[model samples]
Target: MNDFYSVTAQPSRPMGGRRGVFRPGHVQLPVSGVTPNVETHVAIAGDWHSSGYWARQALKMLQEQAPGVRTLLHLGDFNLTANVPWSAYRRNVVEAMTASGLERIFVTPGNHDDWGQLGPRFQAHPNEPYRLPKTQTIAFLPRGYRFTVGGRTFLSLGGAASPDQGKRIEGKDWWRTEEPAEADAARALAGGSADVMLTHEAISGGSRLVDDVIARPNHRLFDERGLDASRRSRAIVTDVWTQLSPARLFHGHMHVRAEGHHSAGRSVYSLAANNSPGNIGVLDLRDLTWAWLD
Candidate 1:
């Protein structure tokens, strides 16, 4: 296939940034003795239905195609409806990751993670704090987080706000507040020299922003509110890009596989959703290769 995607992390002139090991706990027993300079393979997927069928399939594919992968990440949108049982879905995800022999698995929240209505009953559990390691602060925010794997760093950003949520916040808006969160995140990434950015929603500015792509359906939240979610989501995205300018930004939500290079005067990979077999995202590290199973 002519549509192959691969990007490598090249060390920029060493700027003397603090280095730290990832200590986040995983459902699959504790991991000890992580070596530096070791290549890490990671599998990322998101926007799963509440039934967890897609998550299960993605893990199965990872096991078969990217065996020996050290970590897996689910960006968000794990439930089909907010009313679905998270314990059941989490159990499914953890079981699959452990069965695949992955060292760790990380997850971020999506709009559907909310407790009522179309959202899932997802609150930060003591067992799972919805947090990941950062090169800077140890404090974790529910909005977003970061982690490193395969000798590269990844920043995961949350999605846009819905109209209902907006009304509750009064004058608060998603694009405005989310921009700061994303900007601060980018500063952290820049400070850490992060190599990649991952989010549940696509970044609309750079190559991730597609032409003629209807970011939201007519009757959906975006349409009813006149907010192009994909474009609005980009406010945070471009903010990060303007700062860290990571080598890649992998995202899910469109449910279609997309690949494009951003002309941000630098190489920034914009990866689309890998929600299907044909549209999977493939990344080849020096030692280990991972395919983002849809």
Candidate 2:
């Protein structure tokens, strides 16, 4: 098993000054032995919930804890509400990345991010690729979208069925499109194999490490019980895993930290929200080994 260490560290500069609510201090994990041959040091995080405070803190933590990271991948649920202004979301995310010294950021939309409000802003134009604002070095990936970086092929599939949909105001807080369509799953599997796969929901048959971690007292919010919705969501993710057979699969939305190997030989990891300490997952593409970082 890999050992973990926490050391006091500071950012290259002050992060957003003291006003920044999420101030990170004294947490660092060395990647010396784990990443020797790794072509990419990707930092994975999830469920920011649009809290600028946590976003700043999480990015700062990632910078200080895992240096030399090449890409920042946010699994999903980036905003608190789907109705948040696109411009505001863009600005906050850009500032955080700038402070963290990140040049490239890729995001997938979670249920909270898919509220009907974001559909028009992120909808793809005919024949043109969907992309986020250029001012911010961020790109939003649609379900089944695939891209490559650092010689690793990564596929992105985003969406989840919200258990609390009944409580949310239709068109403003919840959207039917929050779940993946059959076509989206088909498109995701069209590509032969992926070095890495990213989603907001976990596959069906992985070890119950994630469920076990989140089912603890006071953590019941992570567990939802709509059988039909659960099955649909799991089916899509399971199908994708079976088809692409990625070497590593990463997901968020459960808001817990856990890792386990799937039956298909893929290593699956679930990350906690940015608001929680030690919520980052660092993956070394060279060997597909990973560890949690604050």
Candidate 3:
């Protein structure tokens, strides 16, 4: 059990409301407990990147390590690149999860997951199934989506700017929509508070230990893109936290395990990359207690 450092989110300033604002789709799924008197376990992981091999291995490990897990929550970066077609990515992920005997999965999209590019693809391929069985999985949550399981509410907002975009081609590997719009953020906050918050990027305001783990060297090609991107992400997460005031937050992007806390007893857990062995966050829905299975 690792100790977490506590920090407090500053109060959010009031912003004027926008009329006729577009809101992302809200999804709610129902999950049943397998047995009575047993705590429903939810397994959380990060950055699977659609690697069939990795997904297979990771899910198998999860089953072995946390056999009681009833649901799976992914914190994003599920695909290798935005260049890959959404159909291919979806197929790969579904097949892998099915093979691993994982039925229920909820995911928030990361930068590499092509956060914003799926709209047109869905329109173009009208017959292609984009969503899985709601009872089995909620494949993708764009932004401002919330789902409930075992009497606990989880809000998920997914998107992150890619510092490595400089090395990739536009439309093929990079997308401008990797970050959420201001309106999207506002809409997410308007949904009110949640018991647990899930996102692709960790909040910027954390203890020095967290800062140290998230800091990355600047790339010559992208200059300060990494730093700038992180700052932007931090601002968004900060706003979300200040407004929603969730008791617990889980995110994935840095690909390292770290934990932090807020003055109000809000715990923040950043998970390790899902492709790695033994990287899973186990949550006890009965009491909201969580820990790393690794």
Q: Largest lDDT belongs to which candidate?
A: 2
Worst 10 residues of 2 by lDDT: 26-35
TM-score of each: 0.63, 0.76, 0.76
Local accuracy of candidate 1 as per-residue lDDT tens digits, 212-285: 35443445333444354345555665666566777676665555555566554334333343345533344543
Candidate 2 per-residue lDDT, tens place, 1-294, comes to: 032222222223222232222222221121112222222457888888777777777778778876566467888887534455666766777798778776556777787775464455435431122345455245556777766544567888888877666556667767777777687788788877988899987676554876664334232332344335645886898788877788888888777777777665678878888678546767754455686776
The window of 10 residues in a row where model 1 has the poorest summed lDDT is 132-141
Provide backbone clash counts, one per model.
Answer: 4, 3, 2
lDDT of 2 at 109: 70
User: Clash number for model 3?
Assistant: 2
Clashing pairs in 1: 40-150, 50-80, 82-119, 82-120
TM-score of 2: 0.76
**Which has the better TM-score: candidate 1, or candidate 3?**
3
Count of clashing pairs, candidate 2: 3
Per-model RMSD to reference: 10.4, 10.8, 12.0
Q: Candidate 2: which stretches are off by over 4 Å?
A: 1-39, 80-90, 115-129, 211-227, 263-265
Give the better candidate number (1 or 2) by TM-score. Answer: 2
